[model samples]
Target chain A: MIEVRLFATLRQGREKSIMLDSKDFSTPGDILKHLDIIPGEVSILLVNGFHKTLDEKLEDGDVVALFPPVGGG
Target chain B: MERRYERNIPALSDQECRLLRSKRVAVIGCGGIGGYLIELLARIGVGYIRTVDGDVFEESNFNRQLLSEQPLMGRPKAKAAEARVQRINPRIEVEPVSAYLDKNTAAEIVSGCDLVLDGLDNIAARRILAAACSEAGVPYIHGAISGWVAQVGISMPGDGLIDILYPQGVSFRDRSVLSFAPSLCASVQAALAVKMLIGRPVETGTIYYFDLLNQEFETIRLDLGKKE
Candidate 1:
């Protein structure tokens, strides 16, 4: 299974973490599509500590986090 | 000599003052933090400054924005900040761009700066700026304030420390619950920018939070070794 995490403002909308079965897909885009997140709404994506483009593939046990843009100051 | 920067000349030697006069800095926002930062940098003899902000002064800003006033109500923040900086130090050059900093323009503005200070209020712009700095191999000083609490950090390329600390899309909603917090954060950010300009080694990649209500300060070192 792959782990998907949401942070910051995005956490306000949904569960913080979600587990996806490994057999469902092979990349981060698959999970994003499965979850039905709008493309532009998710500004930054991190997989395994590195910024990843939407096309990047996901592996089992991968931790993917999504965040929207937030301004506080 | 015009006797410009006489006040700062004593605190920083003539040679160091020259360094300040020769450096160029890019400040991304001209609100609370950016307004104070631009004023400090200009007064201290920072050679050149590029200010960006697509916002204007609203009635809400009069409380904490030093540059905001009734006379300047509804004026573009960039222009107001530019005017104030010029009033403080006419010898320095100030370029005020009234626009938002996005991916396409971030590189162009940030590429030439010796240091980048985070004066923005939102995370999206912050992340874009951070990515641009990393790609350009420049050092970035970041600060955020929300409701009596403020956070500051310095990030270098390849460190991925901010990624761990903020962890992409994680929004601390409580950050905007109060107004005074950004003022405190801006003050700290201004000090950090000054420290960076004078060739000092800043304690980078650590988050420092200040709680004004409780008068508490806490430092959290992000686990740089952590991976997704």
Candidate 2:
């Protein structure tokens, strides 16, 4: 299973963590679509603790963290 | 060594105090987080401070900006920071740029500075400042707030933490911050700056994320190739 974690504004009205079968999602963009999150709304998308593009392939047991933009002084 | 910083002793040694006095820092943006950061650094006796902000205090800034007052409204934010620094510690040297840092001016603003602090509100300005600091080989402490959450981190030279955190050409949703969010975040940034200046061990290339409302704090280590 792939573990998805959300932070900051991304957690609003949504579970902080969601689990999905590894075979069900192919890329971060696929997971975002399944979660009903727009690609443009995400600012940081990390897979297994490193920066990865939306189209990067995912593997089982990978930990994905998503954070929305929080730009303010 | 003076009576003003007497309370900082034990927490900070006498040698560290002297080191702080000899170091110079540049704070970009003079609203919200910038206002409190300037005041804290002044009280801590950072000898030289260069404040760069082209914006002025408006009525709306009173909710969170410490330097924003009825009398100071319509005045340049950097000038207000300088005055506040002087009022807190007269011996500290303060330079008010009174101008926003752009591509052409970012490098010059960070030049000759031991450290740079981010108090910018927009992604575009942060990208410019972070690139300038990277080019100048200076360490930058970044802080940002939105409502009850904030993130603070130190970007050493080429980490490109800003770029990693904020993707290029991305549109960020406009979020309003509460009055206490900036103050809380600025204090954390100031503490980190003090630790770095005093030769204390501060973990770099990692972002400290805070959720004040839920009392949850987490540190996310960036894979910047410098982590031990």
Candidate 3:
């Protein structure tokens, strides 16, 4: 199972975290697509608590977090 | 200890208080986060501050910007920050650079500063400032806000912290910011800045995210080596 976490505006109308079968998804981009989030909408994507690109391979039990661009002063 | 900063101790030691008075910091952007940073630093007795911003306050900023008073709508934000600092602590010296920071000017703006604070609202400017600070071997404290959420972090020289969080070409529309977001975030940055200025061992490569709406706060360590 892979755990997905959302932060900031990314959490609006979405579950903060959801568990998905790791075998069902291959990359973070797949999770975003399954979650119906546009790739451009995400500014930061982290896998297992480190910065990762969208195409990085997903592993079982890996925790993925997505954040929208919250750049403001 | 001076009576002005009496309340600042024993939270801050006498030596730390004196140390803060000798440090010079550059605060980029003078609107939301920058205004509060300037105010807090001035009241905390930071001796020298250089405020950089080319924008002027407008009616739109009144909702979230501390220095955006109705009377000063068209006034330059950097100048407002300088004025506010002088009013807060007459002894503090403030230099207002009423210009936006760009690649050509970023290095010069960060040079000769002990530390730099990010009050910028865009990823492009933040990246430029962070790179300039890194090149100058200065520690940078970043603070950004959107609505009730804020992220604060410290990036030591060569950390590439900003890039890790905000990759290049990631652009998004400006989100609405409530009045309290920048205030809370700036306060957090101020505390971190004071801690760093007094030679305390401040952590680097970590981002603190605050979700004020849910009252949730979490710190995430950025392992740059794990970047993929």
Best by TM-score: 3
Backbone clash count for every predicted candidate, in the order shown: 15, 0, 0
TM-score of chain A of each: 0.82, 0.94, 0.94
DockQ of each: 0.15, 0.56, 0.69
The total number of steric clashes, by the backbone 3 Å criterion, in model 2 comes to 0
TM-score of each: 0.72, 0.94, 0.95
**A45 Cα displacement, candidate 2 (Å):** 2.5
Model 2 regions more than 4 Å off = B225-228
- TM-score of candidate 3's chain B against its reference? 0.96
lDDT of each: 0.74, 0.88, 0.88
Model 3 stretches with alpha carbons more than 4 Å out: none
- Ten contiguous residues with the weakest lDDT in model 3 chain A: A38-47
Question: Where does model 3 sit among the CAPRI classes?
Answer: medium
lDDT digits (tens) for residues B1-228 of candidate 1: 237756676667777778888898888898877877787778777889988898988988776677888998889999988888888877678888888889888888787888888888877788888889888888887877666656777888767755654544455546443556666776777677777888866887576666565576656455554543
Fnat of every candidate, listed in order: 0.28, 0.64, 0.70
Leading candidate by DockQ: 3
lDDT of 3 by residue, A1-73 (tens): 9999998778888998899999999999899999998876786688887778899999999999987777888
